[model samples]
Target: MSTSAGAYTYSMASNYNRVPKSKVVGISGSEVIELVKRRLLKTQLVKMFRLLQSLFQ
Candidate 1:
């Protein structure tokens, strides 16, 4: 959903089905950004691990 200021907000459906949800981000007159999966934390952790490995190597 969007507000009067044009900022959009998204949420997941709380139903009996165990389906996953996605998030969307966009700017005015720009290409829309879509998050097909909810893996933000995992992605960050992977990145950090790679960085640490590189440093140790």
Candidate 2:
């Protein structure tokens, strides 16, 4: 877990001011078998806005 955390910064850093995105992956002794991906900021913002609009309707 520590190694994964350390690698996240380097592996995930894009441009400054950009929202960082990553997936929590599951590995089994050098083999990856599971991954949980995340939506980007734009997608998240859009979803939130849509939900807010629906609530007001």
Q: What TM-score do all the candidates reach, one by one?
A: 0.37, 0.49
Highest lDDT model number: 2
Tens-digit lDDT track of model 1 for 3-42 = 2122332343432343323345544676666544343556
What pairs collide in candidate 1?
none
RMSD of each: 9.7, 6.6
Cand. 2 TM to true fold: 0.49
List where candidate 1 sits over 4 angstroms from the true fold.
Answer: 1-24, 27-39
Q: Find the 10 residues in a row with the least total lDDT in model 1.
A: 1-10
Top-scoring candidate (TM-score): 2
Q: Please give the distance, in angstroms, between residue 7's alpha carbon in candidate 1 and its true position after superposition.
A: 7.4
lDDT score at residue 43, model 1, on the 0-100 scale = 63
lDDT, candidate 1, at 19: 32
* Tens-digit lDDT string for candidate 2 (1-57): 323355565466553455545556667898986465644778767877999999999
Deviation from native of the Cα of residue 22 in model 1, angstroms: 10
